[model samples]
Target: MIEEIRIQNLGVIGRAHVQLGPGLTVLTGETGAGKTMVLTALSLLLGGKADPATVRTQAQAAAVEGRVVLPADAPALVRAEEAGAELDDDGSLLLVRTVGAGGDGGSGRSRAFVGGRSVPQAVLGELAQALVTVHGQADQARLRSPAHQREALDAFVGPQHRETLGRYRTAWAERARVDTELTELVERAQDRSREAELLRLGLGEVERVDPQPGEDVALAEEAERLAHAEDLRAAASGAHAALTGDEDGGTDAVSAAAVVEHARRLLDQAGTHDPTLAALATRVAEAGYLLADASTELGAYLEDLQADPRRLEVVHQRRAELGTLTRSYGADVAQVLEWAAASGLRLLELEGGDQRIEELRATRDGLDASIAELARTLTLGRAEAAQRLADVVSQELTGLAMAGAQLQVVVEPADAPGPHGADRVEMLLVPHAGAPARPLGKGASGGELSRVMLALEVALATAPHDDEARPGTFVFDEVDAGVGGRAAIEIGRRLAELARGSQVLVVTHLAQVAAFGDRHLVVTKSTSDGVDVVTESDVRPVEGEDRVRELARMLSGQDDSQAARTHAAELLELSSVGR
Candidate 1:
């Protein structure tokens, strides 16, 4: 609820500080006394458009500030914190808006601040939804809107119905998703077929080659060995000859094995004379054995080495085939094999595209059936709630002095399902008995429309809802525009009733309405003269005799008249009885 409002240089309100509190607070004054400027200040705080013309003459700028107390878990509070707004020491949010005077008589710029931190005007607008509901004469047009009617009926049905509506919306969204997927699959059937064909061809080529994990590397090694077989054979033979001197004893030099054996015999003969000679003989014998083993291995290698052109050509052809696979698919045989495995899986999926499409269609059909059922459920729920709402609001209209009027909340089938439902809800008014039901504003006067709106609001508020769903403050701008007498009193009573659970601010001219206010503020205008004459307006709360005089002024335009004061006191007394 708003705790206070401070406005400066705005309209006729040069500087005014209006203190507000819980319950119904009414603003009243004589014509041209700047009562409307109070609400205009509120509008600025609500992020309404700013007009430079609203800036007081000779003022550089117009500014409005508001202090609102909100619940700890309020959505508006959460949003404000998200925007880096800080709460006051008393836990109230401070909102401020300023409109600069345009230079050279052009349009001016507007700025908004929440909790002392600057924010976008749109942020203020977003917070306004949960902060207050403002009803003006122009809002009668909004009441006639079909969408708004649906929303009103839904709100009246309470949270359980809203949960049902949420379920239907979720199901509808899922159905849309399924339908989109099904359509895409059907439209791309030929593309899937072509993809499958390409995968199959690639797999066929890979299977024909039958490449192994390391085939390319192994083949390259074998090819190198075979290509140099002659050189390998010749090198082995030369090494063997050197190790054994010569197998045919063709060299004049002694064979390595024989030379070592001779050295061992000489050392043994001298061992009888010197022990050191015996150790040398043992080392010479070990060398002779190692030379014989080397000669045997070399001979074996020479025997195994051979040149085969046919085998070389076979290895080359195999390498070329693997290269072909590598060029298109991968870098080598191993990579090619990996690609084959992956493509095989892809081929399976592509081949099953037709089956998958059919499965999707089946799923979509099931969802369609479920969605249709939920839509019907929503329609039925709304229809039932509409009747209850109409009954209640019609009763409200009766109390508002439209004794024979009736409210008809009509629910008709829509052309197709929407996110809301498959029904169009409209509120029709029957001005009196035996009269045709007409859409709101069709045959109803401005006063009747105002009553209908008020009745609807009261009826909706009768339903239980948490604070988040119901705003804490409501502002009415002349809701008693064309209303008078008992009807005006009923309007005030309803406003007071609405305020039992929230804060209510009404801009009114009727003393009956003013009498119902828990707090009354009156705007007074005066002209001050100095070097230049200046007109200023101030808003001050009235009480006791002052309130009575203000109410008298509102009633008969003569505060000193005894008859008017008596009537004003009587209205106040009547308004107090029910409280």
Candidate 2:
């Protein structure tokens, strides 16, 4: 149910808020009083096309917002969640729309949000259909949409065929998945073969290099040592000679030994008197021994060192190969291996596609047979449901003053099978005897079409809907058009009957229809402040003097007349008892 509609700065009406109640609510006003603006605001809430002209003059923007109460299990909640929104615990959906940017002067935009989460305008539009249906001169033409046809039929069938349709849809979804896989496999089969060969060749090329993980550091150090081998040997030999004071023939061994003995004798003489001097003499002896050992090791190292060009060439070749793989994959051999593994799986799948195709063909054939059977069963179910729907619709038409107008549900073969079935069904009508029946799109007039649409809606009122979780609120802009007197009275009564389980709002000029409303709102125009529109609602239960005055004004444009008041009073009394 719609809780309230609040609009601001949108065309002629600066600001207006309407609090709606559950029953037949009527809106009556003089021409051009902006009564239609209310419908336009509702259209924006339903994701209708936006026009910059809707913005009030000198205003930067226009806005429309509405609050709706839904059932706990409403399908609208599921759609909201899919769009990354949540609903209130009380199942209220808040919708908002804004138009006209600062000063760009372009077509304004609109958006919807649920529980403070933004959603696509299309998603909100789909949900809005379940919350409200608008009937008017041009807007009522939407009743011809194929989607509406399917939905109407679904409603007519109720839950009797739900499980079967559910199964059909599930199988169709799986079939689509397989078809997509098959198409991709066929497109890439040759490419995968070529790619697999390239991977194998690349892997083999890198393997031949046999690159070690840390070998680059080790090889660089070895190359540096070999590059300066001769220089290093010369430096080491000079150091050895300096430390030993000429290793070959610079000093005699006996002289060196004598020096050492003299130093020790001097230390011994002072040792008993000075321990500090003895410690210095011991350190000099140890240093002389260390220098002698270093000279020996350096001589051996210099002889062993050599430069090898062949070894350098081998190291450079391995490094170059490793570099290629590193650039192609990553800076590591492990990463290259991982890439190869993933590519191999994809390659295998592609290579074996022909075989997979054969297997899928067999499965597809079996599914085709199953779907065919289900389609036939669905057609049978629709045929049965169609008959019952036609009967109910005929009954509603009679009450809506469409007497002798035959309503027919025509089910025919589709050019191709759909998820629902292989048949297309639509409502057709023959307005009178001897008149050939024609499809709704081709037959009904503006007012007749509106009434037909209403009949279908009333006939399809089953267990409400998952998206609504309750009966939808119906809004009729001019449902009573081309109707008057007894016919208008009957139409009003039928609307009131529909309101027993759902809320109904009608825009009409007919006093008979207006009298049936449980709540009445009148829209008036004033030029005192540059042509503003205002709507006033009488919240109290209208009866006796007040009801007669309001209906009298609607009837003859003069509520003060005694005769008009008397007639209006009689009309209300008759409607109350008839209802």
**lDDT tens digits, residue span 1-579, model 2:** 788888787777777777778888887767777778888888888888777788877777888888888766667656666777666666687888777734466456665665577777787687776677676766456666655676677667756576678888877777777777777767877786787788767657556655565665676677778677778877876665665556543453333434565676788678778889878778767755675677678778767766677777776776677678778866666666666667667657666778898887777777788888888888888888888888888888888787788788888999999877888888788887788898778888766776777777677654334434334788888777776778788778877877877888888888898888888776665553655644233122355676678788878889898888888887787777223
Best by TM-score: 2
Q: What are the per-residue Cα lDDT tens digits for candidate 1 across 1-579?
A: 899999888877778889999999999987878878888889899888888888887778999999999889999999999999999999999999999888766458899999999999998998999999999998988887888889889888877778888888888888888888889888988998898898888899999999988999999999999999988877777677766777544455557777788899999899888989999988888998999999898888877777889989999999999999999999998899999999999988888878888898888888788878888888888988889999999999999999999999999999878989999898899999999999985778899999999998899788866567778899999989998999999999999999888899999999988899999988888775431211333577888899999999999999999999999989988997223
For model 2, the superposed segments whose C-alpha errors exceed 4 Å read 46-50, 65-130, 160-167, 207-228, 232-304, 309-346, 352-370, 462-471, 535-567, 577-579
TM-score of each: 0.70, 0.78
For model 1, the superposed segments whose C-alpha errors exceed 4 Å read: 9-14, 30-37, 47-63, 78-84, 98-113, 116-123, 195-359, 525-537, 556-567, 577-579
Give candidate 1's error at residue 351 in angstroms: 5.4
Predictions in order: lDDT: 0.87, 0.73
The residue pairs in collision within model 2 are 75-466, 75-467
> Can you give the lDDT of residue 237 in candidate 1?
74
Model 1, total clashes: 0
